[model samples]
Target: MTTRDALKIWIVEALSALGPSTVPRIAQHIWENHEAELRQSGDLFYTWQYAMRWAGQILQNEGKLSKAGPGRTWMLI
Candidate 1:
């Protein structure tokens, strides 16, 4: 798979592995463990955020996840 696809897989697996997390925590884990795959971000996340919002929206829409807080914490539904 390409890097973006790998990132989606990594994020899903990480969410499954850790349960739930603040976006920064998830991003930190990705940066720490998957550096090889992560080296290509080129600062896009800091500027635009990554796909976290998009994923949460899709999951929430699908009823697979829900907002856990008024802000960024999300949980499986």
Candidate 2:
């Protein structure tokens, strides 16, 4: 899958696993959980900022997620 696609998939999995969480928190969890995968893939792994913006855009576009109180935490609805 493409980098953005991989990010989206990861976000979905993380949201399901952690429920609502801030982007940084999610990124930390994913980084720790998938360090092996990241090492094999190199820099396309995406940082916390990209994950946050990309996921919010993708999920908002798809209507699977929503902003809650205009903060970092995203709500899956």
Best by TM-score: 2
Candidate 2 weakest lDDT stretch, 10 residues: 40-49
Q: Per-residue error at 37 for model 1, in Å?
A: 1.0
In model 1, the Cα lDDT at residue 42 comes to 58
**Model 1 CA deviation exceeding 4 Å by range:** 40-49
RMSD of each: 3.3, 2.5
lDDT of 2 by residue, 1-77 (tens): 23556666777777788888887777776777766766566566555447557767888799987667357587678
Candidate 1 residues 1-77, lDDT tens each?
12354555556666777777777766776677677645556554443235656655666777777667556665655
Model 2, CA-based lDDT = 0.70
Best by lDDT: 2
The residue pairs in collision within model 2 are none
Displacement of residue 46 (Cα, Å) in model 1 is: 8.0
